[model samples]
Target chain A: MEKIIVCIKGVPKPGSIKVDPETHTLKRENMELILNPNDRPALEMALRLKNTYNTEVVVISMGPPNVIPLLKYIYALGADQIILLSDRAFAGSDTLATSYVLAKAIEKLSPFSLVLMGLKSIDGETAQVPPETASLLGIPSLTNVKDLFMERGKWIAIREMDYGEEEIEVTPPIVASVSPLAFDYIRPPSLKRLLEVKTKEPLICQVKDLNLDPQRLGLQGSPTQVIEVFEKKIETKGLVLEGSPEELVEKLIEILKDKGLIKF
Target chain B: MFEKIKLEDLSKENILAYGEFYKGELNSSSLEILSPLKEIAQTLNKKLILVSLIGSLENIKDWEEIKKSLADEVWFVINEELKDFREDLYTEVLVKIVKFSQPYGFFFPATKIGMSLAPRVAGALQVGLCAHVNNLEVKDNQIIMARPTYGENIIAKLISKSIPIMATISLGAFGIKYGEKEPSIKEIIFPEDFVWKSKLKIRRFAPSKKKPTKLSTAKVIVAGGRGLKNKETFQKLFELANLLGAEVGATRPVCYEGWVEEERMIGISGVTVRPKVYIGFGISGALQHTVGMENSEFIIAVNTDKEAPLVKIANLALIGDAGKILELLLKNLSK
Candidate 1:
């Protein structure tokens, strides 16, 4: 089957993030996990390709047991298959280690023609795993892909550059990262379809099953470390204005004029 | 526990600085690395080298002054195909160079281009890297880099046990300035037999005619956020911006919603701006957006909700409808 595999992460929702002062580590106690906001675009893009072609879309993730429901939600969203890379050994894997494990799992699911991922995860905010997985798998990769389509058996992706966008083509068994801002936000699948697939279990791939080296699995294998974290002082409040819109604007203009920002 | 190893075997080469450029001219953010890196190079007693990939080869005329005054030695890898950025090409070429240099320290600008490529290279080498660091210090042969996190609510001090420590520094954190002394130069040829035999192809190249809002260099900026609502209302930001002779900037969601151009977005993922005067209309000051603009000299945020994060940061937190306030301000200013 012509298939595309998407790498997804289940990240804790933004705003409730709290760090432990004593350990200098992220405090996940009572935190609600959600599908990473950034990865939705890539999933949406992959689903679009599936609708247009004779292809199967697969959603793959490496997270705790909680990630299974998320993969099922993706399955409900038109994914043909769900694969979860979950194991105690996979805990504390940084971007490099995470990509290594992901590349191995992807290899296990062979005959895949394309790989799609979001630009970065909200929690770690590293944005490294997608490209790193592409490199480890020895495939040509494109980052910041805003627009994509299949033409003449090649994948055409418009990548966002510093000043503008550039269009490029890559042969399959290649990787492309979707920009969160580039495409239209994903629409919800029908309620009936979502409920039907929410209970299906994803195929779980353990550490040993992937044939990865034990020496390169988790925290010990990662090279960089966060020595400490500090609560930074926010800048003090500026000026507070309470009045009608006209009065507020007038006060603003007065302040600007006082600062020589307005002449006359 | 991890420190009980021989440090002598580590790759202790010069500090490697990535040279970011647009067209043929160097980006202003590129110069931010030179001075801080020079200090670290001295502390480590290693040289500071520039690893530049020139998409279009020209005489050192454009970069001569920077080379002479800031860097110890300059290394350029020229590939005419590099006139535009291709991730496969840039990553492949940079991987080869990193293998050659084995840098003790490496710095990248915290822009979209740099953020995208740096992680890929670090992943290729299987090392650790800190992203968007605003401050850095080197003491006793260890690099301590401070990076903001959790919406700028916390600052994380990072250390890389990896031999070649890598980080992408924030733009305004290390302001670009000129230096005086002339430095030396060298060139490394792009690797042969390294193209991987037509792995990827450029089907088409359509450059975005849109330029970065020039918010960083502007003296005055009038930024709008989601509160402005639709594209038609967002256009009012331009009207106010023009009236004040200011540049236009927007929150990330505004750009993501297509109300404003993506290039005009200001946030951790977009542009970092520190204009003399920044006026926000209907902005909620999410950490993502505020991180990119907190350095502004004077901040004026307009919001109907007085408790919004932007209100806390603004020198003038105007409690009102952003659209209404902007309309009145525009009308009164013209009179």
Candidate 2:
């Protein structure tokens, strides 16, 4: 049977983000952590592939020990098995370092026919890790994939390229960064699956267990360092106008013109 | 103190190109990189080098002239099969040159072809690579690169810990400028018998032709959000944009709702714009959406919410109905 691996990230839940006024760091206390929104599309895609082709879907994530709750959630999504790569050494990693660790873990999990991931994580928004990860593994990869299917042991994908859409056909051992649009057609998780997931335990892995190169798996291995993080000060104050629609628009146009936004 | 250099100074730095002109003249993205290379070279007082894989030295006369307009030295590698961009061939040729010359820094446009070649080069060299940089500067004998994060909401500064720092600049970040003085150019020839491997096959080569909306370079831009309600109201926003000779943009929600296409969205998931003038109609200025266009020279926000975030950053904040304001703007512009 074909095997597939789906990489997921547990991030701070949306609509619950609170920033510390002083440090500008995200407040973790009382904030719920869940799988990244984009990862749902990846999970759904994996599940569809597994069900259609009688394949095994393995979900993997790297985060703190507190991220276990999210691993359970992935199991609830019909993933056959899950692994969590939790280690303090993996903290404060940028995309490059993160991709390094993930690629190493993928090597350990090799022999799988396909690998899947979300196009980006909402928290980081770098959108570079998946492609970088594929490069490290030396595999053909497609990004921003809106649709995917398998026919006669080959994978067909519709990818969003810089200039237009591209339909590519690649044999197995391919990586794909799926777009959120792919999940719009998925049905909600069934109750039986949720209950089964809650009663199950995920296989956990640590950096030590993976035997990865210490110099390339964490903060110490990272070549790029963040020098500073600060909020940008707003420089322009807004112009407030309260009047009839016709009057307000007339004033707006004049303002735009004076600013050279509109010549006439 | 941060010192700035003029574009003309780039003629002193070494500029190098790899591979032949498969698709005609150097890619536009390459030209964009040359703009900053010229400026950065002047600041560091380095020589420019250009490396080519195919065609005779005379065939690249125009490229040499453009480079001579700014570059100091050019290296040409003549190989019949090296005309097109191939990962294995390009990587092999580039790695050898980069190892031999040991340039202080390297820059590539963040195009698909460039993206494919950059990481491989970095990996082969055993160095770190920074991608999608918006700004690059030299300070205290180190290259400081700035890249947008959090969907352009935040700018992250990074420096290479390893030698020969490499980065790929986002396409729209650097602006092209002409230098005043004609540059001095010299050519170097590479010996034959370059080693190459062919592991990947080119099943097909078709252009996607997906053009990024030149929102970042627009002189003026008109944006809308959830408040625009429906396609009809969004149409009014476009009308105003047309009258102002500006491009039309939308918020994330509006784009997600399919009220407008994704290319028209502005904010973290959308394009980062620094237009001369920006008009926000019925937009709440969510942090994700605001960062993309916040750098505009002037901002005008029209929304019923007086305390909306859009109002806070706008130079002119009009507190009124977005639909009504759009209608009035269209009427006045028509007059």
- In DockQ terms, which candidate is top? 1
Q: For model 2, how big is the CA root-mean-square deviation?
A: 5.8
**Could you give candidate 2's per-residue lDDT for residues B1-335 as a string of tens digits?**
11222222323224443222444455455555667677677777776554455544444435544643444444555555465555555666677767667777766776655665666666566567777776677788667887655432455677878667777776655555555555444333344444554333334445656565767678888889877778789978767777778888889777767777777767655666788888888898877777677788888888898878788898888888888778767777787
Worst 10 residues of 1 chain A by lDDT: A22-31
lDDT per model, in order? Answer: 0.77, 0.69
Q: For model 1, how does the per-residue alpha-carbon lDDT over A217-264 read when each residue is reduced to its tens digit? A: 766666666778876445548777889888999998887787667777
Tell me, by lDDT, which candidate is best. 1
Q: Model 2: per-residue lDDT, tens digit, A201-239?
A: 778787788887778865577776656455455544755
- Candidate 1 positional error at B62, Å: 2.3
